[model samples]
Target: MIKVLIADDQEMIRSSLEIILSCEDDLDVKGVAKNGVEVLEFLEREPIDIILMDIRMPVMDGVLCTKKVKKRWPQTKVIILTTFDDDDFVFSALQYGASGYLLKAGDLDTLHHAIQTVYSGGAMINPGIARKVVDLFSQRQNTPIIQVEEESVNSLSELEWDVVYEIGHGFSNKEIAKNLYLSEGTVRNYLSRILSKLHLRDRTQVAIWAVENGYIGRRS
Candidate 1:
């Protein structure tokens, strides 16, 4: 089962999510926290696979909490659960290593799917916020690459290079697998290896590196 921790300041929201998620056989509610402080406390004491974190909170906000969690436990995945889709929050959360973003009002199924997607090593942007993420990245096209290390360029295998090239062109894993004539598992394994080899944090970083290094052109 996928263990999850829900962190939100509101009592009702936390209770409601706990109920909705408890029904899924593959998911289990590990714990609930009212704010980021409590989240950190819980993390100190429990073993959690994923976190559904709220953006705005009392003692600490989700973005800060996410950064701390990532620093301390890099394997624990986090998905932002927020009522607002503010561009600043979305971008900040992503930069801080949140694997997914979901609106608080998202349906149960969407929330569940986001959890599963992030847990499986894929990024998830709520459909409503996806356009904003795309627009934000598009604007960064003109930004110069000031930090590409030789290590980053040397770490990818030829097959992984092909995968990153396709990903840089905005192809999903399923699409990349189809084009490469590889199974989905093979594609995912390649990606995981690529991330490790390149010393990258996530797919977004890989995409950025590909574009910045001219491995794939911005419009490719």
Candidate 2:
């Protein structure tokens, strides 16, 4: 089972999420926290597989909390859930290692699938935010351009390269699988090997690297 923690300041959201997620056979609600501080406390006692985190909170915000969680407990993945689509929050959450970002206005089913995707080592970005991420990432002039050698480039198979290109376009593994005519499990395996061979972290890094390396074309 994929153990999950709900961290939000609002009791209503926390209770609702607990009820919704606890009903799933493959998902378990490990704990609930009112704020980032509580989230840290919970992690001190036990390990969790994923965190359904709210972007805005009282003591410590989700972005900072996400950074802490990823730094101290790299195994734990975070999915940012929020009512707002503020660009700052979007960029910060992804930058801090959030595995997924979704608007709370979306259906519960989308949220559930996002959890599963992230738990399985893929990413989920809301459609609206996906475009924003591409635009925002393109606007950044700070990160240096590092041209990968042909040797490193040739290390990945054509399927793996296709996965990288899809990831660059912010396509989730599920979507990539459908488009590439491969099973979702196969796409997940390809992604894992891609990350290892490329020496990158998560799909977010893959997305950024794809943008930088000119791998993402207009089709992407």
Candidate 3:
């Protein structure tokens, strides 16, 4: 089961999440916290696989809390929960190692899937925020171009290279699978090997590297 902790200041929100998440057989609500401080305290006492962190709270905010949690427990995945599509908060949370960013207005199915995706070493971004992320990265200036050697390119098999190319294009596992006539599990496995071979962290890094290195076409 995927163990989760919900952290939000609003009592109703917390209760609603608890109820919604409890219906999923694969998920378990480990605990609930009112704010970042309480989240930290809960972590001290429980074994949690994921955290549903709110952006704004009384004491420490989600971005700061996410940084601290990642520092202390790098294995624990965090999914930022919010009511707004604040670009600053989204970017800050991502920079702080949040595995996912989700709007609270998202349906229960989406929320459940986000938890599963993040727990499986993948990422989830609210569809609304995902467009913003793409635009933000696309608009950034002064990004240094990377020149990868032919030897590095030759190291990857054709299939692995295909996976890398798609990731560079910002396609998720499901999308890549659909495009390539492969299963999502197969795409994920290929991605795991791609990251290992490329010495990259997540798909975001892969996208940046791909663009800078010209591993994939710029306009795809």
Candidate 4:
């Protein structure tokens, strides 16, 4: 079963999500936390497969908690589930290693799919949130790549540039394969090469680097 822990300040939302997830045989509502502090405490007792994190909380926020969790338990995945969709929160959460960014307003099916997607090692993003991230970086596409070394950009091949552009726009591996007319396996291999060439840790860093370097919102 996909073990999940709900971390929301509101008791109603926590319990409501618990109830909703409990119905799925493939999913289990492992626990619930009212805030990030409680979420960490619960984690100390036992590891959960995923965390349905809330952005805003009293003792600690989800973004900080996500960073901590990834640091302490890199195996566990985190999906930010919040009512607010601020651009800062979206970027911060992803930058801090959040596997997914979803709005609480999404339907139950969508939430379940997101949890499953992340559990299966794929990132998920709400359409609205994705648009915001794309827009945030798209505006800076013309800002020029000053900080990144000139040789680093030249290291990638033409095909790798195609992968980088898709990643910068937050497209999934499966989506990128279809978009670029390549198999998923081929895309994954290209991503691995791109990460090594760019000295990025993972796809998230690649996405960030691509945006910062004005790789997105432009043709190859």
> Regarding lDDT, does 1 or 3 come out ahead?
1
Output the number of the TM-score-best candidate.
Answer: 4
Winner on lDDT (1 vs 4): 4
Say which candidate scores most in lDDT: 2
TM-score of each: 0.81, 0.85, 0.81, 0.87
lDDT of each: 0.80, 0.85, 0.79, 0.84
Between candidates 1 and 4, which one is better according to TM-score?
4
Q: Write the per-residue lDDT of candidate 4 for residues 1-220, one digit (tens) a residue.
A: 9989999999899989999899999998989998999999999999899999999888999999998999999999999987654666766778778888888889999999888878876778787877677677667676532235568779989999999899878788889999999999999999989877877656766777777666786666
Give the range where candidate 1 is weakest over 10 consecutive residues by summed lDDT.
Answer: 211-220
For each of the candidates, the C-alpha root-mean-square deviation to the true structure, in angstroms, is: 3.3, 2.8, 3.5, 2.8
Off by over 4 Å in 2: 143-158, 183-186, 212-214, 218-220
User: Model 2: per-residue lDDT, tens digit, 1-220?
Assistant: 9999999999999999999889999998999998999999999999999999999999999999999999999999999987755777876688778888899888989999999989987788887877676677677746623335567777988778888889987788788999999998898889889878877788877776777666787342
Greater TM-score among 1 and 3 belongs to 1
In angstroms, the error of model 1 at 182 is 1.3
Superposed model 1: Cα runs more than 4 Å off: 140-147, 150-162, 165-175, 207-220
lDDT digits (tens) for residues 1-220 of candidate 1 = 9999999999999999899899999999988999888988998998899999999998899999999999998899999987654767766677778888788887888788778877877776676676555566667667633245678667667788889888666566787899889999999899988877777789766765665556764221
Off by over 4 Å in 4: 138-149
RMSD of 2: 2.8
Report the backbone clash tally of model 1. Answer: 0
Query: What is candidate 3's TM-score against the reference?
Result: 0.81
Backbone clashes, each candidate: 0, 0, 0, 0
